[model samples]
Target: MSSQSSTQGAALAPEKRETFSSRKLFILSAIGSAVGLGNIWRFPYVAYENGGGAFLIPYIVAIFCAGIPLLFLDYAIGHRYRGSAPLSYRRANRKTEIIGWWQVLICFVIAIYYAAIIAWAAMYCWYSVTKAWGNDAEGFFYGEFLNTADTVGVSFDFVPNVFFPMLIVWIFTIVIMVAGVNKGIARANAVFMPLLIVMFLILVVQSVFLPGAIDGLNAFFTPNFDALQNPAVWAAAFGHIFFSLSVAFGIMVTYSSYMKRKSDLTGSGYVVALANSSFEILAGIGVFAALGFMAYNANSSVDSVVSGGIGLAFIAFPTIVSAAPFGALIGVLFFGSLVFAGLTSLISILEVIVAAFQDKLGWGRVKATLIVSIPVAVVSLLLFSATTGIYLLDTIDAFVNQFGILACALVMVIVFGSGLGMLPKLAKHLNRHSSIKLGTGWMVLVGGIGPAVLAYMLINEFQAKITEQYSGYPAWFNGVFGWGLCGLLIVVAGLISLIPWSKNSKLEDPEYDQHQQNVQAEAVPETVSKEY
Candidate 1:
């Protein structure tokens, strides 16, 4: 299809589509999405485990090569097609619509469990002030707080502590999502991102001054260059970068769809990338310094106390809060940061799902927001309120990150590049209005190296998951929630894509009205577009 014809839908729907009011707001919102809860807990351990300070090598390489370039690709598609993930892909190419729906489903799964984590963070923020965990932080988290089940399975018994907060989270999210893009999403990021940074900075400084902080810093910065030789290190960098930057998940695509025409697409992406990486590095410094204090308190090494994800956030950090000087302050800052970060990222995830359905059904923003979000909220509440919630969360998170996200990303890149031969077309769209021009190099990195790295990471993940049980969860549980759920998304997304788009949708024979004609006249011609 010609680029002009492919992009005609966007021109027809200018009033219907909401955009970020300014480039500055767009950058802030983008950074808010990228600098998620993982930036604090997961990144520090990922850096320390992969190569300590030496991990910076592949980390930078991954961000510049895979992360930012892919960001621009999302920008191109969304900005050009002017729709949500499904609508954007449908506009880009009819056959690729399934990829977009798959993203929405992934977001759906993530939002369901993700709310629980944010609720945990909110509770922990209060617990920080009270030091509610008492003497045994780990025991309090696993036993007293969660009231976790003994085995890996689903249950109906509810935990009020989890249920209430999860409910509150959903209510707050619904309010924000219903408010629409400019009023809700942009404003929330404007509020949350700065607050997160300030709280985190104070926390980092406080942790650094605490006893044994230098030891943690040393442990973090101390490089084992020999680790660089391991392919796993590079893979770790690529994997973390992918998750960290929120690339290829229909997020950037949806967010960028809101950018004003003639916006500096690539330049803004570079800024978002830089801010995100800088935040992660800052997180590493703060987190490791506290872990060092934890090690010192235990009369042990930093390596012993070092961990990531839920353990680090819930168990390890809480222990640090109990032991470190100004511990209450540390707890508040750290946990509060989690709340802010998680909320922003969760907003982005839900937006992907909400926007997809909104565009597909051509429903009003408020109507779509309620119809989609309420059901998702109900599901999240029911599943995550149970005693078995943690078990299910852990298994589902593992599968989604490994199988769902990684596999889907690889397929999207392949289909867009070699399978459809659309890189040339995409690259042209990016360079036309973008301040930072892209040519063959951007094409090669996104189309070639990007796939190679993702393919390698996916292969490694599949091999490890297939050969061994993930997190020692039961085989049945893994098969049902983990592998089973991932496969289910693909089939469901395919079936949904086959359903005819509502006549109200842009996909249904959009008229080539005067607005579209004017847009085409102003747009750079597609005279140069061709299959790659």
Candidate 2:
């Protein structure tokens, strides 16, 4: 066989291949990573908070205009380079790889807190089966999960049960990575994703049957033009689209690096977007419908029944589930689906860290996975500590998800969208075989409008912090903790950027001859040669 065909065929062999993800498997795994608890638990609340049904306007627009283009960009970059985010970014543009590292850094922070949240979901799943959460759903959660007193005073508690489950989660993640992609991640997604969809459909059906469901549905779908007119609402909608789709982060880049050359990224991009948005719509229907029922029964506004943070899941969801027929069964299924979703995403995030370790430190995949898992596991153990531990998790989650991600995303836009002269090259590659070709229009969006909006969001986010510090918190606690944490993260990221290793890095420019040779080798027709 020709050298190129030989490599392609070798990739199919289980024993010889280093990374064994197929085009089919890549798509499935990508879908699994993208569709998660965020779609079910978070999106509903965000949709409700923003503009209700009116949110869909900006949301749909963002998907096409922003989300899909970025998704394809990551895929094209990754598949072409056949490396993880750090390597892909460096391979694309050596100097610009620093920006990619920033994205990787964000994923690392997210993995710490994200795993904790997943642990919470696993705990809920266990409780569902054990019936530990009795009919007094809200009380059980607040008393057991959210309220504990220790040195930190009244705060959340990290039970041993929660921590142990997280260990299982970490183990599960490593095993999937060890399985070499196709057999592990792909097979897992093939099984779990369908189950997620089925459960969602069943919940939607059940929710619609609940009395006052229409009121919730109407509230969710009905556009509030007033809210739509607000620029902040539009920004929120766009940001949610970006965050929920898992763009800006290097996860998509890493995942796509495993794709076969012939993979139709534009087609797969559409599939991922459709599947993701459908989950959001389904989640909105499920959540608001349940809220509508709750409102009708309680004779109050839906807002009264709503709560934020983990309370929404641990408290509000369980309360809603208890009122339904076969409550325990449904609760089990819902939380089970959540565990699956979170696990899938967690695996992708951890893979980014593992890949970086392997590329930078020259460690083998197994060694890298184990090495990364150890420190993460050790830190994650803190989440099991008494009251103080839970507070740390909350603070970490907010700081990382809100600030770190936004910061990394802005840097990525600046680097990929502006710093490196890859926009024209990217547009050309994206347009080459793409059914929906992205062009100069996308360049303007990513380089100009996208960055401006991301900057505005970051500023607003920090301003919100300031407002909360001065006016929202108690005098003693004001500005002390929150600002300190934010400042620390900033310092850490800045120090990372200054490291000598990043200063002289050389990234392979995608438009260069070497890159073209690599792409041509991979994309060559199967019938062209079989002689090696």
Candidate 3:
């Protein structure tokens, strides 16, 4: 087929795009994408709630069986096709292309709110110097800083402090995006990842020396094995693994697509997985140690100071830092780490949206970066950075994560793993180029085991939603901002997918390389009907 042939998607047309300079750079970037605020704040609480130290067993199991396996699948598909999620999916099976668009849309929503959190981190970094949050950290965070209003309604009231920091966050993200992949994403990760680890390690060491550090460690590591018997504990483990790894967000798919053809897909996936999980455990230790100190001083227990999500980072940690020895320096290291972690993850999320625009519309890096980043900034400042920002952030996060992100992954896994019989083919591709070869067992994990777990998670979330509104907001609020917002994303993705693709895409050209077509041919089952 001619490269000019309109039949094949524009993504297949011969073209050169930036790639990571080396294997190490790619792996670090991938690790950076996976390591985020979630690793630091979210996972520790999850482990505590599930089974404390015992949670590691199921969490590790979920990593190999579901998380790493899916990571490999995403790597295999993207490396073979060498396109962003939308273009790559379209090339794999025309019908499944919408899945890519769905992921990108989910990423768009994530980028807007994710940056807002980063802005909080940036402001908190300065606040650390003066211990500005005072003893009542929660009160200052919710009352003075956020000036939070009723959860049921949206607030347009501008909080200039929030807006300015958020503007910086967006500016930093856009400048990095404009740098392109290697110089931008890889280089940024190369710098930030090490700094993040060092700062976090310092925090952990400082935290462990405190009077009640052992008490914090006990609460974090003491295994409540009986909790393991509950199915919800198992579910939490799997869910944490999935969320922490940054899978199903089109990030791994997009990042892997930039890999050199000779890159070790399986080995790289393993590295990223292990690195992410290891950081999570480290973060749990540091967080709990700090909380333990807080409890000791307050004449309370670890449970009193323990929290997760934004509360843990912005409120609890600040509270702990204020009363601790060398409060200024410790607070700086803690929140500074948040700044680094948040930036790396934010860029990855925004990259998905930027790549979508560039791939489908053939826009230059600068053009695509501005088009997507500006609207996101406006949304962040106006809607999500206000006094009511937390409300919108929580609602959108719940619905988008449950319905938008997980839903896309579930559908993709079902269609490709079972419907089209792509699991083995993708495994073959991974093993062919990767140093660590995969086998039939990997296929079983991805095709059967992973999807079943994901389906259960999705169903469980729905059941929980039915019984009680997520985070206990008003039903009307959940209906609009939660489900209603998610529905709008779907509509937007569908509309965007209808845009005309550039025929000049290298993937469309047979001469650029016949390998992509061969991989797709092998990936699709001949007996499968064309309709789906």
How many clashes in each structure? 0, 6, 10
Candidate 1 Cα lDDT to native: 0.89
TM-score for each model: 0.94, 0.86, 0.93
* Candidate 3 residue pairs in backbone clash: 11-507, 12-506, 12-507, 12-508, 12-509, 13-505, 13-506, 13-507, 13-508, 14-506
Clashing pairs in 2: 1-530, 1-531, 1-532, 2-530, 2-531, 94-507
Off by over 4 Å in 3: 1-13, 506-532
lDDT of 1 by residue, 110-204 (tens): 99999999999999999999999999989999898999989778898899889999999999999999999999999999999999999999998
Overall lDDT per candidate, in order of appearance:
0.89, 0.71, 0.85
Better of 1 and 2 by lDDT: 1
On lDDT, the leading prediction is 1
Task: Give the alpha carbon lDDT tens digit for every residue of 1-532 in model 3.
Answer: 6865765767554556668899999999999989998998899999988889999989988998899988888887777667789888887886777788989989888888888888888888899997787778889888888888855578898787788899888888888888999878889999999999999999999999998999999999999989979999998999989988988898998999888766788888889999999999999999999989989989999988789988899888888778889877788998899889999999899888888778888778889889988988788789877878889889998889766777788888898889988877677778765778777898888888888998999898878777888788888889998888778877877877777787544436243266555545564545332211
In candidate 2, what are the lDDT values of residues 304-372, reduced to their tens digit? 886555767888778767676666666776787787788888878877777765665556667777888
**359: Cα error in model 3, Å:** 0.8
TM value for model 3: 0.93
How much is the lDDT of residue 445 in candidate 1? 93
